[model samples]
Target: MLGIKEIEAIIPHRHPFLLIDCVEELEPGVRAVGYKCVTFHEDFFRGHFPQEPVMPGVLIIEALAQVGAVSILSVEENKGKVAYFGGINSAKFRRKVVPGDRLRLECEIIKQKGPVGIGRATATVDGKVAVTAELTFMIG
Candidate 1:
């Protein structure tokens, strides 16, 4: 398990923009499972909807990407590098994620060649999928 500090060591993301709160499971260069504790205080909630706070779907995809980053960046040779989004394919938003939801992020590197790779990613709340995507990344 990795807290925010250790996650920061692998990925370059800070508070407010750093959507992931903790990593529950990680396999360097392969997969990672992380969490985001959604709260009413989220900055996006202010503009996303004041009366009804819903975590943005794009941000949910970003959270999935961040988890995938931890998996790839933790590799010894890739340490200190950045994983830039190459593309996002087949992204789908299935359910609404609101404040007080503990969003679970799961990502597995399903394909890789050289510095480019693809991950099958998913985000869930209470075991119900909220979002999913095939994310491509370029390690630089």
Candidate 2:
């Protein structure tokens, strides 16, 4: 498992923006599984909806992307490089993610050609899927 510090060493995300909490599984340039412990303390909860805060779908997608980043960036040749979103396709949000939920994120590189690739990603809460997407990334 890789903690926040170890994740930081591989990617460029910082506090607040760094959505993933820890990586439970990883295969450099192949796939990764990570988690995000959502809480009421999240800054976005303040303005997203005061009465009933919900983790934004975009942020959920970003969290999944971060997991994909870790998978690709962990490759020796890709070390220190940043993975930028080339595109997000077929994203579907099935359930609302709220505070206290432990978000499980998984991403597998489905295809790659040079620095560009596609990943199959998903985010789940408990045992149910919260979101799923096909992400395209460019290593820079």
Residue 133 in candidate 1, Cα distance off native in Å:
0.3
Count of backbone collisions in candidate 2: 0
- TM-scores of the candidates are 0.99, 0.99
lDDT by residue (1-140, candidate 1, tens digit) is: 99999999999999878989999999999999999999988889999988888888999999999999999999999999999999999999999999999999999999999999999999999999999999999999
- The CA lDDT of each predicted structure is 0.96, 0.98
**Per-residue lDDT of model 2, residues 1-140, tens digit only:** 99999999999999979999999999999999999999999999999899999999999999999999999999999999999999999999999999999999999999999999999999999999999999999999
User: How many clashing pairs does model 1 include?
Assistant: 0
Candidate 1 Cα lDDT to native: 0.96
